[model samples]
Target chain A: MTATAAPFRAKRVLPGFTLSLGTTLLYLVLIVLIPIAALILKGAEIGPAAFWAIVSSERAVAAFRITLTAAAIATAFNAAYGLLMAWVLVRHDFPGKRILDALMDVPFALPTAVAGLSLTALFSANGWFGQVLHPAGIPVVYTIWGIALAMAFTSIPFVVRTVQPVLEDLDPSLEQAAETLGATPWQVFTRVVFPAILPAWLAGCTTAFARSLGEFGAIVFIAGNLPFETEIAALLAYIRLEEYDYNGAAAIALVLLGFALVLLIVSNILQSWAARHREATR
Target chain B: MSAPDMIAPGSAATGHGRPARTMGARALIGLAVILTLLIVVAPLVYIFARAFSEGWQVYASNILDPAMLHAIWLTSLVAVIVVPLNIAFGIAAAWAVAKHRFPGRGVLVTMIEIPFSISPIIAGICYLLLYGRQGLLGPWLGEVDLQVMFALPGIVLVTMFVTAPFVAREVLPLMQAQGTAQEEAAVTLGASGWQVFRRVTLPNIRFALLYGAVLCTARAVGEFGGVSVVSGNIRGQTNTLPLHVELLFNDLNAVGAFAAASTLTVIALVALILKAVLEGRRG
Candidate 1:
């Protein structure tokens, strides 16, 4: 502790601790923290009763239900599609595989507004996909299904990207041993392969679900945005803000923020658990 | 371990020449290809198709419209300003969190990721609450006569928030895995902090940095919900490309909307190509 002995930081090898950490902290506080704090402070100013009143309104309730349900449907679809994609990309070899892999990232790279517009066009009565489905008496535009489709489109990559590496690293000998033990392919997957990828799969789904929950640009175009139906919580918040009801907007936003925070925490926990599980198996 | 692991997934008893297994593999691949075509490829093709629905002349006219040009310029302006600032933030955050251990290191990592979870629309609302006319800082901002909301600054700030994590997320894992040994060696050899980073660290993380920058640029240019909230949606002023597309669509100009959207679609394609190239190089 003596000055002559040098302080702990002084003896440390890496320099720029203060400089680097300071920059990080200053940016986070200015760009990230303060703005979020404004929202929280606004929520606080509204008080508990008023906030509850706004969030519990029937329209608000409907928006929440729709967002959650559509997100759930999107996540479910991604779970199956993503797993299959991951498995195929890692386990099979085929021509154009590389191109297909790159295609998987289109949702992430594409602008949400663009995605919404194209999806709306494709599903409209006169559009390509719509022309076929419309005659079959199945309409997609301005419905919850369309909302789910948009969510699915934007979040398609989350599960595939997360699970691909894990599947790639899976030990073949373990599957071989299961096969030698008189196990069918189904049993091998269920008993050995599925267990191994389960944690990563779940982590991916959680993130996909979170992404779907926050989706806005894409859904608005396709959802038809009818109140109490296709309108999502994010759009509802925007609507509140547009009408100059800051309190109402803040209330709905606070709830959405809470859900996001919870999901983020859950996803982080699941990811770490997956990492530890991988380490254990290795 | 590494060599076997690389071969294991592809070489495993996955297909085994069994008819049932071979059929299963083909079926799964077919399903994946078809689903991807429908879900991902269709919309992409549709963007271009609808963009040129009225022929290339109309598409060209839509893209060349003064309002469309302004939106493009504003979007580019935001991306130009936001990307460099975010890259710096990303480097500093990654350097701090990876090169050194601190009490709240984990918490800092989590905070950096806060934007990803929160809706971009919420981010816009947050800024509006902070800087809008009746916002928390509105009075003081008025006293100072500085406008944040409904201006370029608001658009840039919200875009920055939405994209802040991209570079750091890309660079951090690589930094952590590479360890601090090389940096420590550089320090012992009388190199300054900046020298060590520039000489030793920069080369190591350059690909990841580029990957992150590409992703950040795409996100910044395409950011809708947050920018929409703050930009005030003034035609030919605060409007971005995404917002312009929406405006055109709302005005019953679907062809113009798709034409505007097609430009973004090309950007997205370029980003995906760059990402794939970088991924291969990094590996």
Candidate 2:
């Protein structure tokens, strides 16, 4: 607003609302706001009772329960796996280390449909892992374990990625000092190393959780999608669309959007707290 | 460096038992190897095994078929159109948000990432709502005799929406880290905004752009949930490689579907390579 102070601040980047703000608004309108608003407005055509009835149906509830449960378990599993990966990638080197590091993004890069189909083949009754586990009575595909495994597969990178940079930035000198102290190894890890990485770990877990929650494709073929059983909320939404009920699908999707936003917000707080805790400890 | 380096009395030479460093290293390495093998290698081998199961004759037949070619071509067409547009969107948004911290920056950042959080199926629904015959814009579109839902236009738009954030998300952080110093230098020399981007900034962010493009291409090509709602699955017309795979799967052509899917797997593999190269360069 100040003309004299304008150049000093505007000179920093591409200043002036006319350029940066205008472009940012345009981008959001084109990509995010318009599409989402369209979804909501379209859903508004149906009455409130219809919306509620569709989203709260027994089938819908069952799908949500399974989706949330599987996603939670999957994300929790990934948190441990991801942390181990970040630690290994950052700290250790052995035969084929680079190749192993490269393997982390496999799930991210693989097509969801292919990933889904392959997972089904690998875990089906006659499949490789299934052949081994079937005798042991541990089923995978067409069951909850399959859903969790698929979700976990897709979300593997999120947690590892989040913790990786933070780990890379960590100084061994601090750990060395703690070691030189009379503090035991477990004490050093728990009191020092573990605490420092906790925030990033939580952030990564949140991302993995959110991604797992919304996953559809990778789980569809693998999950039998039986109502009140393995059916994920996303599959239920697709079924709604197939049945030509736009409102039903939108209501489920809106619920998903709400949950994602809430989780993201919670994770943001965790992320900031993690950073603040690190600084405070320092 | 401060108090830690001060060296507590007799601490360095203390015989207090420490963790076995080699033990930890070996343990971590073994775990990492096994996990990577289970998570990554095993699935790939399963899929690849199928490709060879039916012999090279069936593989060659599927790969060389006209229908398969068309589906592949359609996917390429979508990628060719979608990737660059998203790149433009990404670069513009990243430029605006990352270098310049404007009001509502948090809001803008969140807005950009909506596609990332929202279900792709929802992305498809969003398109259906926007351009479907009963949609808000339906009347306007009808006037021009433009049909989007279940058409090529709709497929491309949804792909754009789904992949909206890849390039922008990649570039923004890197740009923010780089600061605006170089671009400001270009501007001081009277480079126009476009010139600043083309000459100064573009070169620096090329790797990010490539990374984002690879991600965008993968998403666009493999897109099912979003595209399914808009495309009527018109085989040889609207059917993408992913759709073909699904359609073939539904038709009980397991071999056809898997064969079609293998092509996508190969594309995804390229995407994997691109990501690794870009990330390695970044690190």
TM-score of chain A of 2: 0.89
Name the DockQ score for candidate 2: 0.44
lDDT of 2 by residue, A26-77 (tens): 8668666887898777567777888888778999988988999999899989
Q: What's the lDDT for residue A134 in model 1?
A: 94
Docking class of 2: acceptable
Measured with C-alpha atoms, the lDDT of residue B252 in candidate 2 is 72
Which stretches of candidate 2 lie above 4 Å from their native place?
Answer: A1-24, A43-47, A182-184, A278-282, B1-21
Error of 2 at A141 (Å): 1.2
Error of 2 at B21 (Å): 5.7
Each model's C-alpha lDDT?
0.88, 0.78
lDDT of 1 by residue, B1-283 (tens): 0011111112122322222247878988899999999998889998988899899899899999999999999989999999999999999999999998766898898889888888899999999999998999999999999999999999999999999898988888899999999999999999998899999999999999998899899999899999989999999899999999999999999999999999998999998888877877787
Per-residue lDDT value at A262 in model 1: 82
Please tell me what DockQ candidate 1 reaches. 0.53
In lDDT terms, how accurate is model 1?
A: 0.88
